[model samples]
Target: MKSKLTTTGSRLNPSQRPAICLGMPLYNQTRFLPQALDSLLAQTYGDFNLFVSDDSTEAGPGQIVNSYAAKDQRIVYHRNEYRRGLIDNWRNCFELAGEMDYFAWVGDHDAWHPRWLESMVQILNTCESVVLVYSQNVNIDNNGGILDKKIKPGISTLGMDNTRRPLVVCRQGQGFGNMVYGLVRARALRQAGVFPRVMWPDVILCIKLALIGDIHQVEEKLWFRRRTDRFSMPRQKRALFASYRPWYFKLPWPLVNAWMLTRSPPALAGSETGPQRNLRFNLAAVYFQRWWSKFGGGSWIGSPHEWRRGKATWIRKLKKFRTAVELKSK
Candidate 1:
């Protein structure tokens, strides 16, 4: 049976409305959901409403969210009747945000520093031209131990022309882990449209936003991304597409990307003749780079040598795990 969409918790008063909307779309993320919620509730900037859209099969996620919602009025919980797939669930979250001034998508397994929202909001409020603002990230393991800290890609496009922003995204938009979680202008997000139900839709969305306005990057590390040994690149791509359409995996990435490019915003397509040619050339280059990185000799695409090397790497990881276990036993 399709579950009826229902909301819990009281709505914010019109006079006390928040300045930003934080959308968290979750599925079977009970383990880290509490931490994620706590991080949001503890934000130094408290003028934001949180919308938690639970797509979990069981009732645990809803129960968890309600427990928090009971105490905090800023959180609004919505449970889907049936599984709405990843992309659709995300779209629903954005839709539920209504007309907030700014919007951000929070990951179920991620945590944000208290200063994150305050800092990002300052940038957007000060710079009228910037549509998005994000900070560096810290990667953590399943046990919440720090793994590494790194600056996210695509930060160099901070002040670039709108026409060149897409090219910068095409080249350096490695993973949407940090960028997608950034605070974005609500108006710009609506104008650019919610995520498309396709492979790496975040990349496409980022490109569209870049065409609309500038993107700012903060140097502070405020976002914490949880890294797990769950899915490889191929598996992630397959799962993302399988969730929406069965035949999506059968299509080549280049073809799919070409079709997506045609659907870019009118501002991008209506550029001058010089910029149009540059966009085409840069997009083609990005496609070629993606193909080379995925299927080239050094990659694991049907390469026995790479497979053997991967086995050796796994063996090293096993040894480390064993050593850690032995230490705990002692």
Candidate 2:
């Protein structure tokens, strides 16, 4: 069910709009809410508005935000009358942003380095062509202790024309999702649609952003992503669509992504020349062929090796069963 959005604070005037806007969509994350807010508030760059959209059921999160809002006028708080799934709350942050030159989506549990905003803002201010700027990320446990897992390398589609950008983003295996949290050009992000209701929406957003302009990566690790089961696939599926959904809404990702990719060319294809359009189609075809070879059709059943292995395993089991039966008869 849909709920009315109630604001705890007043909106900003257009003339008073900040240069950067940090849209934070929070749920039931009271445990680390303070840390998350502190990390952003401590940023060296202070000319930004922190808009928080809360979808948590408990009053704990609201209370925390209220306490913080009392101290910081820059922090704007809005709460839903009832819980409205993940994507809506996320989109709400952007909707409340009014107008801004740059925007970033900060997670409720993720913490950032003191200079994160300062560093990212510098790039956006100086680079005319760059639309998004992100940094390397470090994984942290619930206790905020750094995990020893291998950090995925950063990827950049900078300098690649719009035709080649989608191909690179598709081939990118890990760490690309982090780019969604990076500072983005507000206009370009709007054009891409903040968060589309699709499987792997971050991946699609990155591809769309790539088509818009350049994406750059800061070499340093500035973002701390909390590793938690709250991000499990089942939980994500529920959050991606809505709070309530029928079983029929659940569909396999590959088929959905394939269909999404098929439709993407026309929707995102702006005024492109004939050759550019053909090149994009060819690149997408190449990616699909490679994807099939790696994961889609090539790795699954019907392979000769798998068939032989299954036959050998069944034969051994049958022989063992017969020997046991004969021993019992004797």
Candidate 3:
């Protein structure tokens, strides 16, 4: 079994580097920790390190980390005195990452196919513009039975698409720019600033990483996102949605509008990958449109779903774009 630790805390060189670091932020993943560790051990990419931050109360989570660390020095484990929640746990995981040429993260309940790293890492090693890579993960049940596949778009999007090759992203009618398939870069991540203590740190970090290079999507289901209720769906969108739902959302619309107007940078309101950047920029515009229609005024039709019917008949993936707008309906 390959270990998830880097023996020497060195960074990867430009050419054929020998290390990859997988930063995994976990809470009380005790139910699936063993299996998750098993999957990491089976990864085809050999040299790597795993830094795990456990926010699980009691010693259960710590024991799981210790058991794995004892066997594999690459698995560095740390248990927090108190729960750091999602943002802090993931932030600490990245901070603990050793010098790495490539970087990725796995949810504690998520399992990866053996070739997950081998495939994505190879692409990053060869592609100059590519900063991150991820695959179409299979959503599964607790016992590891496949439940459903992640439905992705048909064509390359401006700021988005499903797991496949490195490309910019796009938004269907629902909107674009929130692609959280775990395609990330160590350099990009390091330079992008730390993940904010927000709901969707993953999404926020991915957005910043996209600004650095093209995020390649690998069209394989090597990553298994277990839907056991501990966590489902990526933290990006859900976090943002949650952040805006508090009593503060009830604050004066004029004040909310002013915050965006005052803070946004004119040069870059999006990603670095040209197309994806534009997609992200416009997607935010769509979100704003809906916000104003609801919060700012009362008459804006951001119904990409209804608009999807306007698109050509051969597109089904536009539904994912529509999914983003469901909140508006409620």
Candidate 4:
């Protein structure tokens, strides 16, 4: 499935090659698309290429992206023949990025302060051991009003052991999945594994990167995240799994956990020391707790048929949990 590029920006000279690639994977987000692009164009740090991969069904989104591409030679635009869903579109956008020192995924509905790129790039430049850099986020309502500020508190994993960093993410990280939008070293991102096509795959990628290097957080709120009520949590999960792994919803939660655990980066897999072992166990426990909260606890108390369903669910969960434990042990 090759994406046909619709428009290419002016080729950068060797000396003018971008320091970062801002990969924007967008769908039918015409309402907020212009704002997002404007924010990128306003970046204080301009040595970055903007690659907009449009998976929108309508022409509005493409038109907007093309309009931006026309004005800014740094903007490269590609519109897909059909909607490739979120994960595929994201992967395609990253792949479209030419060789660059850093890469950052930008959401269509999100906005950034003018200094966002500058602050992140500074960290990546000075800190060779850090693979990812992100700032605190501001949560905005759909209408573009600021709803909350300083949403994610800063936590610096700098100078931590590689194995210890991932555990910290698993336990204390406030914005685990949101780091997908952070500025990251291009080579480290490729090695950690380009966004996996799985539900909440960003979390897995974050863990993988933690196993390789430290993650630095900027205390300032430079990133803005728009919150929408269009898709509930479960609905989003169903759509994500359907698009990536159709069988994911049918399998027991433990099986899904086991599959994702096995997909951890090679760095994490190769280490079998005490800290690594503890990390695996703690992660598994967290997964089980989430699974039980969703499927096993309060939802079980109901009619006879519901009770029977609950019993079956528990049995399946236990069986799959044991299987995952055995696999991790080996």
Per-candidate local distance difference test = 0.73, 0.74, 0.57, 0.73
Clash count of each predicted structure: 1, 0, 20, 0
Higher-lDDT candidate of 2 and 3: 2
Q: What would the per-residue lDDT of candidate 2 be over residues 1-330, giving only the tens digit for each residue?
A: 111222233444557444789998888889889999999899988889999998887889989988999999999999987777877787889999988899999998899999898888777766667788887899999988999888767676655667766677666635657888999999888877778666567866776677678777887889999987634444566676456653434664444544455443444556667765665556456445534332211222323343455433455577699999999999
Q: Model 3, range 181-224, lDDT digits (tens) per residue?
A: 35466667666554644333443455445445655556666777
Error at 236, model 2, angstroms: 1.6
Q: Over the stretch 157-251, how does candidate 1's per-residue lDDT look in tens digits?
A: 65566666767766666555567788999988876777776566787777667767777677778988787664455556544532557465467
Q: What is the TM-score of each candidate against the true structure?
A: 0.77, 0.77, 0.65, 0.76
Best by lDDT: 2
Q: Where is the poorest 10-residue window by lDDT in model 4?
A: 1-10
Taking all chains together, the TM-score of candidate 2 against the true structure is: 0.77
Task: Give me the overall lDDT of model 4.
Answer: 0.73
Kindly report which residue stretches of model 1 are placed more than 4 angstroms away from their true locations once superposed.
Answer: 1-18, 149-154, 241-249, 266-285, 288-292, 295-330
For candidate 3, the clash count comes to 20
* lDDT minimum window of 10 residues, candidate 1: 1-10
The lDDT of model 1 is 0.73
Which lDDT tens digits does candidate 4 get at residues 1-330?
011112124444557544789999887888888999999999998988999898887889999989889889999999877767777888888899968889999999899999999888776765667788887788889887888545555556765666566667755666665677899998888877788765567766786677667777777789888987643445665445324456575665444654565454665556567766666666656654444334422222423343556544456577699999999999
